[model samples]
Target: MSADTLITLDTPTDGTTVSGSFDAKGTANSPEANVPWRILDAGGQKVLHGHFTAEGWMDKLYPYAGTVDVSKLAPGSYTFEVSVDDPSGGEGKAPQKVDRSITVQ
Candidate 1:
């Protein structure tokens, strides 16, 4: 992932395979130390969504980690995404996000 992006996913990288529960860790510059994330099925349907708090926030990029349970999901392809929305509600900028393809097996 590019360092320029506000969020960077370090684990379960692009095309990674996962099973059961997996850890998603990364660095971010998000609001209130809240890092939002989601998993979308191949058909573009949201399967899971939630947020995790980072170790720190505001002044710089901070580390964040969360465990995503996928045992309930059917084995298939999915997109895992992490993003930081513009706290100002898009007054003049867009949200920063990063995503990668993952397969549950």
Candidate 2:
């Protein structure tokens, strides 16, 4: 995963509820399908990170989704990213990153 991925953050009216989804496209007729994601703050700190594995319907769906808790976070900006990775030196591909700046008040 590169450092240029984009993660978009959606802020609701409640200011404490935050949720969104991401999609990592799969290859054509390929059995490999998975996307790793990470949520981080402005200080390069990791808030949450995980991998999602789901089958697609003939390259019709990318299948990536997650929900984050903003109640524990202070009023500030943050970043989220998703990437396709393999442990066998194939994880250097460009990952999707989304950065969002939010204020509590």
Candidate 3:
């Protein structure tokens, strides 16, 4: 993913198989700091939830590095995403979500 995008998952690229816990580093940008993230099962249930932290997150592009904890999940397919909250309760501005599918072993 490019630094200019809204968010990017660098490790465990899409459709990659993995096991246990692994490093998950990516870049994200929100209208604010610390955009939330989650790992979802194939059924779309949230399994792991967390947020991204950057040195600076002021309506600009930034990097968020963290580990994706999947040690407790059974072998299956899941998805991960980085999301941003809606900028106020107004029209035309809604939450942003980006996701990719992965396999667990």
Candidate 4:
């Protein structure tokens, strides 16, 4: 995590072409000890969801790597999102969400 950003994805970059299942990479410093991800199909439907855990969470950011299964979706366009786990702060708050647009070839 940077001073200005919560999480960042380093692979399957935005507006990139991909095929089948691929490795997802990023880094984050989340209180949950893990960061969540969601893969959405062209019509904005969730195709897969999971989380990535680093070696351990400290006061600094840690690296996260995971695999996203895209073998079943008849995809043309999809969004791969990685977000620092945002637990509610006891108020009406939204979770942090970052997204990458990917096309399945």
Task: Output the number of the TM-score-best candidate.
Answer: 1
Which model, 1 or 2, shows the larger TM-score? 1
CA lDDT of 54 in candidate 1? 89
Model 2 weakest 10-residue run by lDDT? 22-31
lDDT (10s digit) by residue, model 2, range 31-92: 25555656677787887677555454234434444444445566565565545444456555
lDDT of 4 by residue, 12-100 (tens): 68898877888888777776678888888877888888888864565766788988878887758889888877666636556566799
Please, what are the lDDT tens digits per residue for candidate 3 over residues 11-53? Answer: 7578878898877776667666667788999889999898767
- Comparing 2 with 3 on lDDT, the higher-scoring candidate is 3
Model 3 TM-score (2 dp): 0.78
In order, what lDDT does every prediction score?
0.88, 0.45, 0.75, 0.79
Quote model 4's TM-score: 0.83
Best by lDDT: 1
Worst 10 residues of 3 by lDDT: 85-94
Task: Check candidate 3 and list the clashing pairs.
Answer: none
Which segments of candidate 2 are over 4 A away from where they belong? 1-31, 57-61, 89-105
- lDDT score, candidate 2, position 12: 22
Work out the TM-score per prediction: 0.88, 0.47, 0.78, 0.83
Error of 4 at 37 (Å): 0.6
lDDT of 4: 0.79
